[model samples]
Target chain A: MSRESVINWIVLAGLVAVPLWAHLSDEPFTITLATRAVILALAAVGLNIALGIGGLVSLGHAAFFGIGGYTMGILAHHAQTYTPVMEWPLLIEGTKSMPVIWGLSILFSALAAFLIGLLSLRTSGVYFIMITLAFGQMFYYFAISWAEYGGEDGLSIYVRNGFPGVNTLVPIQFYGLCLVALLIVLGFNAALARAPFGLALGAARQVPARVRAVGLDPYRLQLLAFTLSGAITGLAGALFADLNRFVSPTMFSWQLSGELIVFIIIGGVARLFGPVIGAVLFVVLEHWLGGLSDYWHIYLGLMLLGIVLFGRGGVIGMVAGRERSHD
Target chain B: MDLILLAEQILNGLQFGIMLFLMAAGLTLIFGVMGLINLAHGSLYMIGAFCAAAVAGWTGSFTLGLIAALAGAAAAGALIELVVIRRLYDKDHLDQVLATFALILIASEGTRWVFGSFPLFLDIPEALSGPVMLPGGIQYPLYRLALIGAGLGVAAGLFLLIARTRIGIQIRAGENDREMIAALGVDIDRLYTFVFALGAALAGLAGALVGAIQSVQVGMGEPVLILAFVVIVIGGIGSIKGALVGALLVGLTDTLGKIALPGLFGLFLDPAQATQVGSALASMAIYVLMAMVLIWRPTGLYGVRA
Candidate 1:
């Protein structure tokens, strides 16, 4: 077997081992934290597809994430109140099952991403980055002003949304759900990256002229990749909401989007396992540093600066040595 | 809306656009001359406000405070260029962006470390504090009018500096072709440093000027920075003329949209709902304008195609 496959297997084994240890030892807190890491990693992985592979440099992935969270939050709220999400005419109503919520969340995030990508993708480079940020800010302000839900205060889900035969509220069970979803998304990402479409997407990143000379519309390919990236990220957002049992406009902030990029960078972009490693390291650092002082962000900022300036290859690159030649 | 309210809002937009112009002019120049995107430009604005507030507090003179702020920010800009930013000119936009982003974090935290969390208050000087009567039975704040006057004066000064001076010729040459000028015996590094400092000073002046109207806090430059980015993007990356027109357009659209959209919507909808919708639309108006501009003129209004 190739080195990457071996390493990938080892990592997968470790991921399975963690939850097993948590459940066997009845360490609920550890299980909860691991679950949180997985959810965040899923979000980062979604961002990786856009930023790392497609070179989109989106600074507004948070909009898709928040849309995902709100889909879950809105559905759960309706379910709790014994009300239908939409009672049109006399018979239509939305369901609050886990599968249903996931589907809706993915759909909503993808749709929003499509609309935003349509406008934002028209511009390239710095203009693209700024436009995405502006749209994110636009949605953020909209959420803040639309007080019908939680407004600035945020909305809480009292009970974890139900899944058949599984008490998803149990930390271990939820972690299992997250792990399954994470694996599926990561597999999709890997497949997509190697697929013909992903090749076109990657080609667009390096030279649009070459890609265009090959008879493919770079814009359409990029939009598709962008939309898919949004959908996966939205799925992560739904899981994140379930994990926290809450959704807030803070989820949609540009700061969060920047952090997601930071995660990919720190772990090593374009690698399937990069976001996972980065998220774990980041949460651990934040937790440890947060305990040390109130000014942890200052230290975190400095650390990130040092990493960006001196360590472009990041942790994974350090371990893996110099990069492989894709060309 | 009443005609007076309409006039006031337009003025507000003009004032905002002018403030944005100050920030964008320096930014566009740095980008045009150097091809570097400095996110820490906002930090310079923040520093200007802090320096102004602190100096005003110590010297008890707003004019002195403004002078100190300009000098201090320019000095800080020069220092940063000499020490850190000079290195990044050869780096990619991502590297520049990340490094500058780090500077923002450092500058913001460092400022807070010195100034504490509470906002520093800079009062409007007595000479510019009161209301001034305008021609159409309208009264506007003397300070805001002064800001408009100051902005126009600076614009004129910038025009003169670029048009009628040796430094202007050098700068224009540098912008057109950095290497040719360097080969022709200009001290390119020093010239760049000076331009950066000049831009920083303008940003600082803007900060101190606006600090009286708003809170002078560590993170105060961020919102304005983003708006300035929008202004420059709409104006075109490396064009001062574009920055000027773009800033005013954004300013007027933003300010006037907030006032007019609500009133316009009120004709068909409930006033309260219209206010909510209008305010949201107003906030988004500048961005929409930017998008439309990009759609029609990809290079911006006055941006040379390159």
Candidate 2:
């Protein structure tokens, strides 16, 4: 295998192996930490499709993330209470099935992305960033005002949602599910990077006029990428909410969005496995530094400065080497 | 609504607009002249509030507190400009955004470490402690009226400085063609630094003025920062005139919508339900307005579309 691919495999193995060992050793806390890292990586991977491939710096991605969380929250809340979602619409009932929640999460977030992208993608550069951030704020305030389903306080799932063959209440089993999900996402991300759609989006990012000259609809291509990106992120959000058994408005905050972007940056933008590395580093730092001081963000801020000012290629670039670029 | 209530609300809107203008003025100036998008501009506002609160609490004089706020924030802005911003001038907006975001984390955490999580207090000056009657028989806070006057005065003074003075001429000239003015022996660096400090001072003044009414706390600047961003974007990013108009429009729309939406919804729904839904929609009113504006004029009202 090539050096970069070798590094990628090593990273993946370490992620899986560490959690499995932790579970085997009865270190459930470590398993939870690994689980959190995996879920955040999944979210960042979704972001990479739009940000890395399409060059869309969506500052409001937390909107979809919160959508995913709320999807799980609303559904599981009803299921726990033995309530139907609604009497109309053929009496749709709540479900604690993980697969069902994941599907709805993807569907709702995709729809939201399509709508937001429609208006927001009309503008580019700073306008796009601000518009997305504004959209996120709009959703955040809406969630806070949503009186039912634990508005400002957030909703809690009494029981962890069930996976078809696994006892997901066990931390390791839940971690395993998340791991499998993340592997699938990573595989999808890698394949998509080589796919025609991804290549076309990359082209559009660099030269929109040239894309149009080739008789391609770059707008539609980007919009589709954004929707898929939202779907994946939404799925991650569902898993995250599940892990905590809680969903709150903070999931939709701009800080969350910024942190997601930070993952992409730290991992190496436009590089496969970049967000993975970034998320791992972040979760680790959050764990370690959080224990050290309440003002740990000071250290994080300094680290971020060093990375932005001096550390190019992020952790991925540092370990895997600079990605060979053609465009 | 009664005329008195309406007038009071309008006055409230004006006060809010002026505060936004103070924030946006500095932001727009920095963008217009330096072509940098500084996300940490909000941190400077926070610094000002904290400084004002600390000084006022220590000395029991709001005027001294206000002075401290201006100097502290301006010094912070200058230091940041020299240490971080100049390097970013030739870089892309992404780099600038990320770097400034890092600064925000630093500023916020540093403040937290010093002051703790609890909010600090800044009392309204004793001279302007009570409500004053307006011409329309509307009672309004005297401090808010003073804020409006200060904002207007700043606006007028800024216009004169930019329009009538020699430095203003140089600033305008530099804006149009930096190299041309620099080649003529003008110190561009000093001018940039000066302009940045001026912007910081304006933001600090706003923070100190508003800190009396609201709790002076960490993270308080972010909401105002976002609103100021909305103002600049609506007014066009680089135009002071645009910032002013956009600020007023946003201030009015946001303030009025909060009052009007719930009432309008009550006509159709029960009072409690109306309130929940109306407030939700009200919170989103300005975003909707922004969307409408973007659709109509993508570059904002006065911003030239690229």
Candidate 3:
């Protein structure tokens, strides 16, 4: 195996081992933290597809993230309250099933992403970033004003949604589910990175004119990548809401979008396991530094500033030595 | 609808647009001159507000407060440019974004550390506190009118400085060709610092002016910052005239939409649903305006092709 592959294995193993150890040692909080890392890793992995591979620096992924969270929250809410989500021409009922929520979250976010991508893909660079941010703010303000579900206050699920034959209420069980989801997405990401489509997308990112010279539409390729990226992030958002048993408009905030980008940067942009490493490190830092003081963000800021200024390559890049060939 | 009420809303929109122009002008200038996207610009706005509030509270003089705001934000902007932003001018947009984002965290928490969690209040001066009758018999706040006048005055001054002054010539030259200007014996580094400080001073002035109407608080700059981004984008980045027109358009659209949309919707939908839907759409009006503008002219109405 390659050096990076070996490190990836070590990181994955550590991810699984820590929560197992936490469960055995009766540290439920540790398991929860690990779960948080895994879900965040999953979300960042989603972003990596666009940012890392397609080079689309989207600042609106929070719109999808919030869509996913609201999907779960709204569905489970109606289920608990015994109300149908829609009772019009075609009756639609709420579901407490995790699989159903995930499917709907992925579907809704993918649609939103497709539409957002269609318009946003027309522009590149800073315009793209600002447009995406504008779209995110659109969703954010919509959420805050759309009081049918919950306005600025947010909605909550009374109980964890059920998965087939698993007690998701248990912290360790939920952690396993999230870890498996993350690993599956990571594997898909790995496969896609080597696939023909991923190659074209990467080419489009590096040299769009050349990609176009070859008779392929760079815009279409990017739109597909953006859609898939949004779908994955949407799934992670559902899982995150389930973890917390709550969803809020804060999910749609631009700050969350910025944090998602931070994860990709800190992990090593474009690395398969970069987001995984970054997310875990972030959670650990938050926990550790948060214990030290209330103004931990100042220290966090300094660290981020230091990294951006001095360390071009993230942790994975620092260890694995400069992403040999973008393969 | 009363014509007088409509006029009042229009004036309010103009005031808001003027404030946004201050922020957007600074942003466009920096982007044009430095080729850097500084997210920390908002932090400088917050600094101005905080400084104004603190100084005003201590000395009981709003004029002193506004001056302190300008000085404070300009100093902070210069320090940041020297220490951090200078390094980022050559980096990619992504690096610039990340570094400035970090500065935001540092600035925000640092502000909180110094000022505590609660908001500080800044009061309008006695002279500009009350309302004045306008040409149409409509009453408007004197302070807001002053803000409009002041903003327009600054805009005029900026135009003069850019068009008529030696520094303005250098700035315009620097925008066109940095190396050419530097080769002509200009101190490029100092010019950059001065431009950045000028932008920061504008933003600080805006923050102090706005703080009189709203509570001076942490995280307040972000919303306005995003709006300013929209303005610049719609105005076409790197174009001062575009920034001005775009800011005014956004400000008017946002203000009028909030009041007009609900009433318009009330014509079709139930009052309750109209209010809800109208408010939601109103909130998104400027973004919709941006999208439409982009659709029509990808480079913006006045923007040069990128």
True contacts kept of each: 0.31, 0.52, 0.65
Residue B162, candidate 3: Cα error in Å is: 1.4
Task: Sort by DockQ, best first.
Answer: 3, 2, 1
Writing each residue's lDDT as its tens digit, candidate 2 over B1-306 gives: 778887888888999998999999999888888888878888999999999999999999999999999999999999998988888888766667778888999999999999999999899999999999888677899999999998999998988998999998887887778889999999999999988888898888888999999999999887788888888778998788999999999999999998999999999999999999999898889989988888889889998777
Best by DockQ: 3
What DockQ number belongs to candidate 1?
A: 0.48
lDDT (0 to 1) per candidate: 0.85, 0.89, 0.92
TM-score comparison, 1 vs 2, better candidate: 2
Model 3 chain B lDDT-worst window of ten: B297-306
- The order of the candidates by lDDT, greatest first, is 3, 2, 1
Tens digits of per-residue lDDT, candidate 3, B110-198, equal: 99999999999999999889999999799999999999999999999998999999999999999999999999999999999999999
Tens digit of lDDT per residue, candidate 1, span A176-238? 999999999988888888889888898999999999998998899989988998998999989
Instruction: Report the lDDT tens digits of candidate 2 across residue range A54-148.
Output: 98988889999999999999999999999999998589899999999999999999999998898788777777777788788888988998888
Q: How closely does chain A match the true chain A in each prediction, as TM-score?
A: 0.95, 0.98, 0.99
Best candidate according to lDDT = 3
Q: Give me candidate 2's TM-score against the actual structure.
A: 0.97
TM-score of each: 0.94, 0.97, 0.99
Sorted into a CAPRI-style docking class, model 1 comes out as acceptable
In terms of lDDT, the poorest run of 10 residues in model 2 chain A is A318-327
Per-residue CA lDDT of model 3 for A1-327, tens digit only, reads 777889898998899899999999999999999999999889999999999999998888999999999999999999999999999988899999999999999999999999989888888888888789889988999999988888899998999999998999889999999999999999899999999999999999999999999999999999999999999999999999999999999999988888888898898988998888889999999999999999999998998898899997788888888654364
